[model samples]
Target chain A: MFEERLKEVQDAVEAAMQAAIAAFPQSDLRDAMAYAAQGGKRLRAFLVLESARIHGLTDAQAMPAALAIEALHAYSLVHDDMPCMDNDDLRRGLPTVHRKWDEATAVLVGDALQTLAFELCAEPVLGDAAHRIELVKALAVGSGAAGMVYGQALDIAAETAATPLSLDDIIKLQAGKTGALISFAAQAGAILAGADRAPLAAYAKALGLAFQIADDILDVEGSEETAGKRLGKDADAGKATFVSHLGLAGAKARAAELVAEAVAALEPYGPGAEPLRDAARFVIARDK
Target chain B: MFEERLKEVQDAVEAAMQAAIAAFPQSDLRDAMAYAAQGGKRLRAFLVLESARIHGLTDAQAMPAALAIEALHAYSLVHDDMPCMDNDDLRRGLPTVHRKWDEATAVLVGDALQTLAFELCAEPVLGDAAHRIELVKALAVGSGAAGMVYGQALDIAAETAATPLSLDDIIKLQAGKTGALISFAAQAGAILAGADRAPLAAYAKALGLAFQIADDILDVEGSEETAGKRLGKDADAGKATFVSHLGLAGAKARAAELVAEAVAALEPYGPGAEPLRDAARFVIARDK
Candidate 1:
């Protein structure tokens, strides 16, 4: 049942995102943006919709925020895949923006996509002006220099450091890089409703770390075809990850523990948050 | 007198922007962002402050919006100077972000700076929630897919096109690339006051065009030392510019006419708009 609901969100978000891109004038830049945003699992959007649903908000009311997170995610991937960054050729089962178009187009595509994310956050249907401004501010805090970008900078710095990062350092880096955005998505519904966000924020904190651990595990064991991107990159670069600090078996155990923690954090909402509970379980169990 | 006012705005904005960047954790990314944001003419910020002043808003009230525009402008320059974009080495009389740091750092600096721009717009001191949302929305419209980026995409496309851009085509491109942001800055005060924005919008439209014409003229006739960057690149690449389509003298005359139109549009404010009139004159007369 949860899988079906997740699929529904994925389809809805994909269509809505396409419609948003279509509103722009036809050009290579627009085409590149559409291509870059095309196919993600939409986990971030799912998190947004589920959290909103638990808060008595309908899909239509929360769709803009969902799209905003996904757009921001897409922009990060586009820049991360650039020749000067990760130098990856594949993303979401197709050529990365830099590969399909050129580097310049890719850069503009990412820049424009980031702008689009903030633009979507200000959509009127979300709520009152105060609520929308709150969303915008929270998003900026979650994604800007102190958030995802900070984590990215740390990751790059780690690459050339004299020593591999310690376990605690890795956790700090991941918290900024991925945890911040996930926390923002999960807490968005509460922000929109002006309700207490502590429980959802806690749930997201554990879930985000678990998600990263799973990604590292996948990099070690998952098939490239299944992941739809390059695998084994971390091991190839000798970068320290959760699996590097803890053995694979230990890493899996820790992730399961995090999933349990995530599930417990949703107890405040009881059965109304079943979808989110299921999402926590799926984070570590999925092959990809 | 106008130069002094402009310099004062520049210094205030520079200090405020530095303080904002300093809040982020120290890293190459943070350093590069600070470096890239330093030393602009701050023309957009001046327009924002001047317009706000005309609307009875104080410098403290309008400063956030002004800083927001300058931040957005800085991000655009950082991305535009990347190896994959303009491949520029010099910006504002200093080494470009990518040259001083690495390509990855430059790209992330631009991304984070863009996020900072939106963050600044949401500053509570700017206004009430509704007014802040309006500023954010207008800024997104000005800088996103349909505005500055669209103009940039067109310029890149033009580089490899079979034919050079015509006079009308260049104007359309310039309007999107530079005019949109200038319009946003100029109209911000009216938006904050919930007043009619038509007059300021008109002034900005003409002023933006004149500014582009001046840039093109500088490319053709100004020295690289004075311009603080490469000159004659347009002619070297055989790109169509105002000076190419309308000869140097013709371009100068057209710029003068546009300045008059910009000044005339400000007649609604009568003598209180003298500083803005002087700004228009400065657009065409300045060496850089």
Candidate 2:
């Protein structure tokens, strides 16, 4: 049942994103932008839409925020895949933006997509001006220097450090790099409905960390074909990750514990948050 | 007199930008962000502050908007100077952000700075919730795909096109490339004061074209010392510019005409618009 809902939100997010980029003039950058924004798992968008659904909001009311997060995620991937950054050649089972076009188009595509994310958040359908502004602010805070960017910067720094990061350091970096946006996504329903954000915030905090730990686990054991991108990169680079710090069995145990915590945090929402709870469980069990 | 006002606005903008970036974690990305944001002419910030001043808005009321525009400009410059983009090594007589650090740092710094621009626009001091959203919306529209980014994509396409852009094509491109943000800055005071945007919009439209023409003239005639960056780049790249279609003297005359038109657009404001008119003329007359 949760899988069907995830597909629903993903399809809706994709359509909205298509429409968003429809007006862009024809060029390699335009093509690259459309390409980069397509074919994501739409996990963030699902978190946003499902949370909103739990709060009694329709997809029509929630999809802009959903698309905003996806757009932001896509932009992050495009830039992260650049030669100067991750230097990846593939994303979502296809050539990355930099590889498909030149790096210059990739850069502009990323720049434009980032602006579009904030623009999508400013949509009038997303409640009042205040709510829209809050969405923009939260997304910026989640993705900016104090959040994802800060985390990425630290991750880069760690790659060149003399010693690997400890468990606590990896946790901090993971929280910033991956957990921040997830937290934002999970809190959308509360923010849009003007409800107490505490429960959802708690749920998101646990879920984001669990999600990253799962990614680390996948990196250690998953294949490139299954993951749909490069795998075992952390071990190859000698960079510290959750799996490296916790051991395979220990990491899996910690992830299960965090998932339980994530599910428990949604208790205040009762059964309405069942999809979110299922989402938490899915974070660890999935191969990719 | 306008120079003094520009300096005042520049200093205030520099301070606000510094504060905005100061809270970012101590890292290369943070340092690069600060470096890129510093030492610009702050022309857009001046337009925002001065426009607000003319409309009886306080610096406190307009500083956020001014600072936001400067942040946006700084990000544009940082990305534009990247190896994948313009590949410039110097800006404002100092090493470019990428040259100072590395290409990855420059890309991340630009991405974070763009987010910071919108984040700053969401400041409560910009006005009530409605006003803040308007600023964010306007800035997004001005800087996003349909505006500045579209112009940039066109510029990149032009570089490898079989035929060079003509004067008319250049004007349309420049309108998106350069005029959109200028239009936003010029309209900031009106937007903040909840006054009519038409006059300032008209003023900005002319000022932006004239500014580009002056840039072309400078590229054809001025030295790198006077331009503070690479000069004769357009000619060297064999890229068509205003001075190529219109001779150097013809470009100067057209710029003068546009300056007059820009000044005329401010006639409704009487003596209050003098600084803005001076700014328009300064667009064509200034060396850098």
Candidate 3:
């Protein structure tokens, strides 16, 4: 049931994104944007839709926020894959934006996609003006200097640092890099509904950590074809990860614990939160 | 009077931007962002503050929007100065972001600065939620795929095209690349006050073209020391510019005419718009 619902949300968000990009004039920049935004698992969108559904809002009401997060996520990936960043040639089982076009196109596509995220948040259909403004503010906080970008900077710095990062340092980096956006996604519904975000925030904190652990695990064990990108990069770079600090089995166990904590955080929402709970479980269980 | 007021606005916006970036943890990324944002002419911020003043809004109410446009403008410069784009080594008489830092830091700094722009728009001091959302939406439209980015993509394409860009193509490109943000800055006050924006929009349209024409003229006649960046690159690259298409003398005359149009657009506000009229004249006359 959760899988079917996830697919439904994914389809809706994809269509909305396509429609949004379609409004721009035809160019390689636009084409690269569309390409970069394509083929995510849409887990973030799922979290948004599920959270909104739990809060008694229709998918239409939350669609813009969902699309916004996805666009923002795509932008991050496009930049992260650039030659000066991760230097990845592949993303989503296809050539990354810089590889397919050029670095300039990738940079512009990412920049424009980030702008599109805020634009979608301000869409009238999202809600009242106050609600939309809240969404925009939250997104900026989640993605800006003190959040995802900060984390990315830390990661880059760690690469050439005098020593390997400690476990606590890794946790801090991942929290800003991946965890911030996840928290924003989970709490979007509460933001729109003006409800308490504590429970969802708690849920996302654990879920995000678990998601990162799983990613580290995937890098260690998952196949490139299934993961749809390069694998074993962390090890090659000698980057400290959860799986490196903890044994593979121990990392898996920690992820399970985090997933359980995530599930418990959603207890306040009860059965209505089952999809989110399933999502938490799926984060660690999936191979990709 | 106009020059003094412009300096005051520039100082205020610069301080606000510094304070905003300082809130982030100490890192090279933050430093690079601060560096990239410093020392622009603050023309866009002046337009925003001047427009807001004309609409009976206080500087405090307009400062966020003013700072927002400058941040957005700074981000564009950082990205545009990259090796992949314009390959610019100097900006505002200092090394470009990528030259000062690594490419990754430059990219991340630009991305974070763009996010900061939207975050500023959402500041409570900007106005009511509705007004803030309008600012965010307008900013996104001005800076995103259909606006500045679209113009940049067109400019890049023109570089390798079989034919030089026609005069009409240049106008269309400039309208999106530079005109869009100027129009947004001019119209911000009316958006906040719920006043008609036609006059300010008209003023900005003319001023923006004149500004570009002046830039072209500066590339030809201005010294590298005064311009604070590499000059003569446009001619060296054989890029079609206003000076290239219309001749230096013809471009100067056209810029003068547009300045007149910009000044005329402010007739609705009588002498109260004198400062803005001076700004129009300054756009065509300034060395940089």
Ten contiguous residues with the weakest lDDT in model 3 chain A: A1-10
State which docking tier applies to candidate 1.
Answer: high
Pairs of colliding residues, candidate 2: none
lDDT of 2 by residue, B48-108 (tens): 9889989888888889899889889889989998877888988999999888888888988
Q: What C-alpha lDDT, on a 0 to 100 scale, does residue B259 get in candidate 3? A: 96
- Worst 10-residue lDDT window for candidate 1 chain A reads A279-288
* TM-scores of the candidates in the order shown: 0.99, 0.98, 0.99
Residue lDDT tens for model 1, B1-288: 999999999999999999999999888888888888889889899999999889889889989899899999999999998888888999888889888888999989999999999999999888889989989999999999999999999999999999999999999999989989989998999888778999999999999999999999999889888778878889999999999999999999999999999999999998877888999999999887
By the DockQ metric, which is better: model 1 or model 3?
3
The prediction achieving the highest DockQ against the true structure is: 3
Counting clashing residue pairs in each candidate, in order, gives 0, 0, 0
Q: What residue runs in model 3 are displaced by over 4 Å at the alpha carbon?
A: none
- Among incorrect, acceptable, medium and high, the docking class of model 3 is high
- lDDT of candidates 1 onward, in order: 0.93, 0.88, 0.92
